[model samples]
Target: MTPAPRGSVRQWLAARPVAAGYILAVGSALSYGTAQFVARIAVTRVAPPLVTTAFALLFGALFLLPLGIGHFRRARRAPGKAWLFIVLAGLTAASGVAFMYSAFSLVPLVVASPLGSVYPLVAIGLTHLFLQRLERVTPRLVAGAALVVAGVVLVVVGSA
Candidate 1:
């Protein structure tokens, strides 16, 4: 039997539509969940927000050193467009990780995780409002956002 072509994988992934998005969402959820748990443990011992932030940032950057180096090189080579996106992406990602770890230090994982997961609903709303012209304001998105908000409320109350 002959092996399938490499392009077939790309075609298959594109054909599935929601499968890729679902996979990405699930992966992100697991990653953030684990990170939050770790952050809680770290902050419990350290107890200083700035110290926790510094350790997390230092270790995370060390872990991604290779990628950071490559990004630096790419940014140096590319003139205008690449720097624009690189700066924006770096700022967005840095703020997000810092805030997420900070939140984990302040709240329990059950509360923080659900609150962080609500970002998807925020992204959906932003996309609908600004990026996409054809996408309609659907009841499902509204219901999903409401449910996420309710879940966050429940988590906060239970934790308290």
Candidate 2:
């Protein structure tokens, strides 16, 4: 098919930014999911899980360090407790990633991968407990969370 004119293409994208945004969001999710599968595959070939985890963390930090400098400067003046909490979060994330890597090495990806995604449920619970003011719980939201948990349960049980 002949290509649409460049101006027409730009107009089309601008006219439907919501659609474009959704496509971009899905694309990002697709890329991250593929990375997880690739990580699972890589761990199978490489014996050391921590090495892969360390390298992945190092590379991600190095790549994003520059972009975060502005935020770092802003955060420096925030309350000291906030900085401590951020440090705790960083430690928690690193521990979680390393454990996930180790889990991928020990268990089937089908198991580790789906169970790893249970964080959404955890997030919902945590938000309800700690961030109640930020994220109010509603019937619809509860129903949606229930559906997601049910789906995960089905997948886990079916795979067994």
Candidate 3:
């Protein structure tokens, strides 16, 4: 099918940003989940976890470098606090991936992957702690996080 006019897509995203955000999050989740499977193979069969983590991070940075180039000006103009937070975010994300790769090397993917997916609960708590002014941690959000944890527990138990 022919693509809709370019501005139509932008207008749609602008009109329904929450829906757009969810769509983007789902896409990211799919990519992350698939990457774990591939990482399992690499960590177990091809290389040790540390080596895999390094190469994976290096390749990831390379892949994003071009996209990031366009935003360099905005990133440069960001305040010191913003830069600090950005660095923290990168370090935490890298450490999480490294730990996950280590886990994958030890356990079966069925076990490791689901346990890793519980990051949402951690994210929920952190958001509540740090972003109280920006976003409310409503009961519904807590309940959803609880459900996610419960599902992860079920998956981990069932895979045993």
The whole-model lDDT of each prediction reads 0.75, 0.82, 0.91
- Cand. 2 TM to true fold: 0.78
Models ranked on lDDT: 3, 2, 1
What TM-score should be assigned to candidate 1? 0.68
lDDT of 3 by residue, 1-160 (tens): 3344557776877777897798789999899989999999999999999999999999999999997899999999999999999999999999999999999999999999889888888888998999999989999989988898899889989988
Task: Predict model 3's lDDT versus the native.
Answer: 0.91
In candidate 3, how many clashes are counted? 0
Provide TM-scores for the models.
Answer: 0.68, 0.78, 0.90
Scored by lDDT, the top model is 3
Tens digit of per-residue lDDT, candidate 1, span 22-90: 867898778767777877787766666557777777888798888678567656878898679778977
- RMSD of every prediction: 4.4, 4.7, 2.4
Better by lDDT, candidate 3 or 1: 3
Clash totals, every prediction = 0, 0, 0
Per-residue lDDT for 77 in model 2?
88
Q: List the residue pairs that clash in candidate 2.
A: none
